[model samples]
Target: MASMFRAASVAFFCILSIAVADAQPIKPSASTQGFHSRARLIGGGQQGEHWLAGIEITLDQGFKTYWRTPGDSGLPPRFDWSGSENVASTEIRWPAPKRHEDAAGVAYVYGKQAVIPVLVKPKDPTKPIRLVLALEYGVCKDICIPANADLTLDLSGADSERKAIEAALAKVPLLQKLGAQADLSILSIAPVAGDKPAFTVTIQAPPGTKPALFPEGPENWFFSASHPAEGDRFTVTIEEKPKDVSGPVPLHLTLVAGDKAVETEVSLDENGKPR
Candidate 1:
C-alpha cells in the first residue's frame, strides 16, 4: 500500500509539470537568414471597441519579399489564425508596394523589411488571445525561393507587446506618404464589346507624375492586359466581368515623381459609370 501511494504521487506530479509547460506561451523563431516575423496587440480592447495589432517582418541583407498583389508571378504571404480565442476579427492593413520587373517577370514587392498593421477585435477581453500566423512568402535573387513559417503570439495583458505594436503602427502613415499619394480623378469608365467584357479607366493625375494602377482584388475578375496612355490624362483598359460588377473595386495607384513614390487608393464606379 505504501509503495502504490508513492507511485501515484510521482505520476501526479509529472502530469502537473507537463500541463504547466504546455500552458506556457511559445515564441516564434526568426528565419535563418535573419528574417524575423512577429505580431503584437496595441490599444483599445475595451468593451466593444477593437484594438490595433502589427505583423512585422525584418529581412536580412539581399533578401526581398512579395506584396499583396505579386504581379505576374510570386505568391504573397498568407496569414491563418482561425483558432484564436478572444479575437473577434483580424485584418491586414498593407502599405503600398513597389513594382519590380526582371527577366523572370513583373512583380510587386517590399524591399528590406515591412510592418503590416492589423485590426483586432475581441468579443471578451477577459479571455487570453492566441494568434497563429501561417505565412508563405517568396524571396528572390536570381530565382525565387519559397519560405514559410508558423508564427504564434500571445495578446492578453501584454503591455510590452502593445508598445511594440504601437511603434510599428506609427510607421504606417509615413510609409504611405513616401510610397504613393497621387490624387487621381476618375474621368470615365466605359464598356466595350468583346469576347470578354472590358472597361476603360480614364484618370487625371498631378502634373509631371506618372502613376501605375493595380487592382486590389482577384486576377480573374480584373485583368492587367491594358496599356497606360500617358498625358495630363492616363487611360488603362480593364476587363469587366460579372464578378467585377458586384460592387466598387479599390485600385492602389502608385505615382512616381522623380525618384520618389506616392500611393493612393481610388474606388471605381459600378457599371462603368463616370465617377
Candidate 2:
C-alpha cells in the first residue's frame, strides 16, 4: 500500500504535491535540482497509531506545479524512499487541487506553495524511523520546468511540525463509505444514449457550492468538462464504458467545496445510475 501510495499520482500530488508532533522545527534539506522541497514527519498523526509525513514544495511567485492527474499536460510527481531506515510502507496522499486552465488545456495544480501529506508506517513500532525521499515534479508558467528534490528526516524525538502537517492533512478529502452521503450528493447518472456508452452525472449541491470535482476511473477513459447546467446542478460527462472489465465499472469522485471536500465511489450499471 505504501509503495503504491508513493507511486500513485493524483494531484494531492506527491505527483500533485509536511509536519511534526507538538513540534520541534525539523527543517529538512532542500533538493538542489528542483523546487525547494523537504520531508516532514507529524507527531501522533490522526489516530496516534501511525506517523504522518509528506513532501513540501515551495514555489516562487507566479510559478505553479501539476497535480497527480495533471488534467491535460504537465508531469506528475514521484517518490522513492529506498534510502530510508526503519520504514515499512508509506501512503502518499494529496490535498484537493485547484483547476488551472491554459492554452495547453485544463490542468490541476497548486498555486504559489504546496504542502503534500504522506502517511508513513514504521518497520518497528517501538523504534525510530528515518525517512529518505527522492522526489520529482514539475513547475510551470508560460512553459513547464521539471524539478527534483531529495530530502531526509529521522523521526525519534521532537515534534514541532503538528500545526503545519495537520493543516495540510485537513485539506485532504474525507473518504465516505460506499453509498454514504455527506455535504455533497450525486443526484443522477444516466447513459448518453449513443454508441459511445458514455454517461452523465448530475450533482445536487447548495447554492454557490462552486464544487470542483476530480474523477477516478479506468484506463483509456476520462471525464469531460464539468459545468453548471442549472442552479445548484452540474453535470460531468464520462467518456466511455470500462474496457475489458466485468461486473460493474466503479467511478470515484472527489468534490472540493471551499474548505470542505468529500470522496465517494459508485458502481453504475449500463444506464449510468449507481447500482
Candidate 3:
C-alpha cells in the first residue's frame, strides 16, 4: 500500500511539472506571471515598404483572455506604443476569436494561445524601427486578473524571424470584397426602420445555422449582438448610434457561420447600398 501511494505521488508531480512548463511566462519587463506574451517584428514587404508584426500570447491551463469586443463581459486587451520612436501609425489585425462562457455571461477570448497580427507603418521606411509596446490584458478562469507586459523588439534584425511572422499573418482575416456571392460573404447591411432604428445585416449563409456576428467600431457606439433570421439572413439591431454625428459611419462586421467566416468594413449611404 505504501509503494502504491508513492507511485501516485510521483505521477502527480510529473503532471504538475508538465503544466508549469507549458505555461511558462514570456520574458518581459513586468507581468502578472499567469501567462507569457511578447511583441515580434516580421520582415518588411517583398520590395515594398510596409512591415508586419505580431503579439504572441500563451496562457496557462484553463485560463482565457478577451477580444476587442468581449460580449457582455471581460476587458479587452489594450496596447500602447506612445513611447516608441519613428512610428507614425500601428494597426492591430485580429484573427477570429473563440467564444467562452461562464456564470456571468459569454466572452470572446483566445483559449490557451493567440497571435495578434499587426501592421506597422513607419515615418521613414529606410530607417530601422525601434518598436516598444506596453500591453495590458485580462486573464480569467473564475476570477479575472490584469496582466501587463513591456516588450521591445528591434526591427533591424526581424529578417531572422520571417517564418514565424508569416505563420501568424496567415491567420489574419481578409476583407470581403464587394458583390461577393460565396455563401460566406455578408450580402447586405440595411437599416431597419421601426420602433428602434437598427441595421439588419444579411449574411448569405447556410439555412438554419445560426451565425455569430461581431461588430467592431468606436467606443461610443453600440451595435447590439445579432441573430440569424429565417433562411440565409441575419439581423443586427442597432441599439444606439453616435449623437450629433456628421461624417460617414463605417461599420466593421465579422460573421462566423459554422466552419466558414468572413469580415468586411464598409460604409453605407443613407439608402443602404454599399458605399
Candidate 4:
C-alpha cells in the first residue's frame, strides 16, 4: 500500500512540473539590426494547432517601413521561413497601413514601431516548434535602403507577449463585402473621364470620422493615391497600366477611417458601374 502511494505522488509531481514548464514565458530573440531599423521575433505560446507570433520592428525617428503592398515607391517586406523546423505553414497578418506622400510619390507605410502578428502552424502539435525567419525589407527617410535580418526562436509553450500580439492582430482590417451597411462603408464608385482612367469613390462614415481610401490592383496596374474631395468623396486616378488591358478592373480597396479599417473588392467597368 505504501509503495502504491509513493508511485502516485511521483507521477503527480512530474505532471505538475511539465505544466509549469509549459506555462513559462518564452523569451524573444535578439534584435537583428538594419539600416535605420531593427527587427525581432516575439511570440505568444500555442493557442490551438498554431502558435501566435509577431515580428516587431523598430524604426529610427523619421524613418518608415513599407506595407505588404507598398504604394508607388518602396518595396514590400518578404518573409522566408524555409529554415524553420516542425513548421507546416505561417501567415503574416498585416494591419492597415497609413498613406504617406512625398516628392517621390504616395506610399503606404508603418512609422516608428510596427508589430506584425503571425499565425504559425506546426506539423506536430505535441512537439516544440523552431521558428527561423529571414526577413528582407526596406526602410526610407529621404532615400530608401534595403535591409535584412535573420531571427530564430524555440516555442516550447505560452509566452507573456500573447496580449501584445493580440492587440496588433486587432488592428488588421476586417474583411468586409463591398457596400456593406457598416459604420464606415463604401457607398458608390463612379467613373470620371480623365486623361487616364479615373474614378470617384464616395464613402459613408460618421461625422467625426476622417476617412482615407487606398486602392490595390494586379501587377502592372497602378493607381494615384486617394485624397479627400468634396464631402465624403475621394478620387482615384489610374497612373499606369498594361497596354492590352480592357473592360472592368478588379480592385481591392482598403477604407481607413480613424483607427478602424475594412477591405473590400469591387469590379468596375469603364462606366464605373459595379459588375
lDDT of each: 0.57, 0.68, 0.68, 0.85
lDDT of 3: 0.68
- Per-residue lDDT of 107 in model 1: 72
* Worst-scoring 10-residue span by lDDT in model 2: 13-22
Task: Write the residue-wise lDDT of candidate 3 on 1-275 in tens digits.
Answer: 99999999999999999999989965543222434433233443422455676676778788888888876678788999886678888888777776566697667788776777667788988787766787888888887778877776666644654566666556555689645888777777676665655666777776655577787655566655545665555565555656655445677888776655678887744333335
RMSD for each of the candidates: 8.0, 14.1, 10.1, 13.2
Each model's TM-score? 0.61, 0.76, 0.69, 0.84
Each prediction's total of clashing residue pairs, residues at least 3 apart in sequence or on different chains, is 7, 18, 1, 1
For residue 85, give model 2's deviation from the true position in Å.
0.7
Tens-place lDDT per residue, model 2, 1-275, is: 87777666542453222123325543445334354332233443433656877577777788888778776678878889898888898887788898777798777788776778777788888887888877788888877877866677766545566667678889988886543555566555555565444556566555666877777666655665565565544455666555455547677777777787777787766444456
Candidate number with greatest TM-score: 4
Q: Is candidate 3 or candidate 4 better by lDDT?
A: 4
lDDT, candidate 2, residue 267? 79
Q: For residues 21-87, what per-residue lDDT tens digits would candidate 1 score against the true structure?
A: 9998655532223233222223323223655556666665666678777776777878776756678
Better of 3 and 4 by TM-score: 4
Compute the lDDT of residue 168 as modeled in candidate 3: 59
